[model samples]
Target chain A: MDFAEICEEKFDINRYLGLLCHPGCGGTSVFMGTSRCTSKISDKTVKALDYTAYVPMAVKKLKDVCVNARRTCAVGNIVVAHRVGYVPVGEPGLFVGVSAPHRQAAIQCMDLTITAIKAGVPVWKEEVYEDDTRAWTTNAECFWLPKPPTHSTDLPQK
Target chain B: MDFAEICEEKFDINRYLGLLCHPGCGGTSVFMGTSRCTSKISDKTVKALDYTAYVPMAVKKLKDVCVNARRTCAVGNIVVAHRVGYVPVGEPGLFVGVSAPHRQAAIQCMDLTITAIKAGVPVWKEEVYEDDTRAWTTNAECFWLPKPPTHSTDLPQK
Candidate 1:
């Protein structure tokens, strides 16, 4: 599922949940992105924030991730939603859900889905500080690097 | 979130969504395992199956995956659930959810979570065929092999 809407309303976990469920699926994975109260540059505590997306492109990217995941993994249903406009601290900025037939596939698909969103989607956010300061931030560095294997003996036993 | 109960209920998508909703996270990964109607042995269509688990041990293993995921990755929540008793063809067999601050971490944790479940959980399944034939199956062979790198210059991504 791909949704692009300007929501100033409260983040609805139930709505996110509803979109992620599929009877045919046995596993579901999700990710939620929230605003941090502290800024890395000024170290100012943030009170609120505003998020915006290049709606058409963002939606296309979201759809692309879902489609790619479905093709790559044994996944069933998927949902991705991002909150636009003003959001308060502790509020979710983005949400992604993936459902599949097996737990492992679901987890793997979810990882790929979220990664695709971050690397490809054109979404931007502005931090609104408690002192009425605000600045736009780009998601250019939101890349994920895979972890090194912990043990050589932990290799896949196929 | 932790749950302990038994009911004749359909799958719950919200719980899975909850697993993904972590504010510090940029990605969420998941895996789902389903019941296939075809058997690997005879390639015959399956009818139903009975699942049994050493409840306490299974729960312990599930919790262990969650704990390990949190420690190893910047994940928000991890969820794993398996069905017991009988399940029909095309039905859901298990659920696993993981949420992390980054897509790579989420994917890594989810992969490990599912792998641990298969290796350590005491859950078992007995397949029932249309001809009243029955046989037990283990998930040992379901372990996946990492795909070879697509390009000579490409380093391993997952």
Candidate 2:
């Protein structure tokens, strides 16, 4: 059975990897997304990150993604869990694990699983900067929410 | 700092993955090779696998591979540990972890590291079958040793 959850507490990679291991499977692949000290877009130094998710929607999305990955990859087992709360720099924000009878399937399944979660999950993030300022991060894939107009093309050209 | 070792005891994936996590890295990818219940070559069931290696040479090769992976993939940290001795079915025989600023680098680095270890490391394996039979598994990449003759063409066909 697949294991999927949105944790309010610290998520452990060791525990998740162990959960994904199986006797029939020969390989396990894992991906961990951690909170970095610097923001990728703005180059601003980040102290930490605060995450919030629409609990019901997020859980459903995670389950759907895991199911899709399992079907596509034909892996033995999988685990997808994300942390929803204050995550310090250097700590994990997302964790994904997959096991299969072979290495390629496990690795491919894990890659796809994480990509789907990042793109489709109803999760929001606030990047807390070292300067004591915070900004609501906009995800390119979360298209359900309205994004602020950025360029002239976004505005109806007068 | 990077973590690299050839272990005689069972290695834990959780510990290695945690060690590879760093504040500067946003992604961590891991690959684990486990002893399966069945052998890939034969239909025979496997009880366990015994691994032996030239420890000094294996350690040096592992370190070199890690350094090369770091330079090529621009990863923040890496861990490569392989078990030397008996590994039961479903237990890990080799574990590799890589962390980078992005997923692509981490994944790519891990893939390359595992391949290098499997190919060049001075390690050998003996597959113990359930039928009280054992066979020395030949690794394609371990070119330093001579392979046993299999066909008449390998000998002087008169």
Candidate 3:
């Protein structure tokens, strides 16, 4: 069976892995997206990440991706989860796992599932910097439009 | 730094994931090999899998693979662990995790690291079947040699 959820609670990697296990499957592959201590865009130290998602739409999209993965790969069980609200550095923000009879299929399913979610899900992230600067950043995987400027030139320079 | 070990204790997915987390890395990918309830060869019901590894040799080989992965992929942190002894069905036997600034490198590193271990490490597994049959099985990823017979059938079937 497939499982998908958008939770406000902490993401449990083991619990999800357990749910993905099957009697006939020997391999499980996982992808974890964490709130890193450093920002990829500005190289500034990051404190935490605040996530907001269109709950109903995001959950439906996650479930749809899990179903699609089963048809595309030889997957036995699949899990996809994203955490909303505040996530501290080194904590997991999103998780995806896949189990299959073979290693290749499990690996392929996990890779594809994560890519689909990043590209299609309506989840948004705001990086909370150590310097108290917060801005909505663009996910590199979502290459649809350019992000708006964080600071306006009309403001006085520091 | 990289970490690799041949452990006798149960595999902890979260601990290894934590080791792979770094301030500069935003993405982590993992591959976990578990003990399945069914055998891939005979389709027999399996209860558990007993693993044995030449610790010194296996650890050395694992470390070497980790180093090679660093040179190949744009990875920041890497962790590989294999559990020796009995691993129950749906429990993890082996785990590999890699973290990188981007998703592509993390995924590639995990994929290659697991492949290398299955092919080169001096680890062995004996499948314990529900019917009390025990036999050494070949890892599906190790595509090199043919496995020896578990029992000789010199006489007629019982």
What is the per-residue lDDT of model 2 for residues A1-158, given as tens digits with 9 covering 90 to 100? 69999999988666776788787888999888889997855667888888988888899999999989988887998999988999999888898989899888999999999889978888888887787667677877565766622441212357
Q: Write the per-residue lDDT of candidate 2 for residues B46-134, one digit (tens) a residue.
A: 87888988899989999998988777888999999989999988888999999999988999999999889987777778777777566
**Highest lDDT: which candidate?**
3
How do all models score by TM-score?
Answer: 0.65, 0.89, 0.90
Best by DockQ: 2
Residue pairs with clashing backbones, model 3:
none
Report model 3's TM-score to 2 decimal places.
0.90
Candidate 1 CAPRI grade = incorrect
Error of 3 at B45 (Å): 1.6
For residue A133, model 1's alpha carbon misses the true position, in angstroms, by: 3.7
Candidate 2 residues lying further than 4 Å off, grouped into runs, are: A141-145, A148-158, B140-145, B148-158
**Model number with the top TM-score:** 3
What DockQ does each prediction reach against the true complex?
0.20, 0.74, 0.72
lDDT of 1 by residue, A55-103 (tens): 7777777777777777888766778777778987656777776766566
User: Model 3, range B85-126, lDDT digits (tens) per residue?
Assistant: 989888889989999888889999899998899988878888
- Runs with alpha carbons beyond 4 Å of true place in candidate 1: A1-29, A36-42, A46-49, A64-78, A88-91, A98-109, A130-132, A141-158, B1-28, B36-49, B87-93, B128-134, B141-158
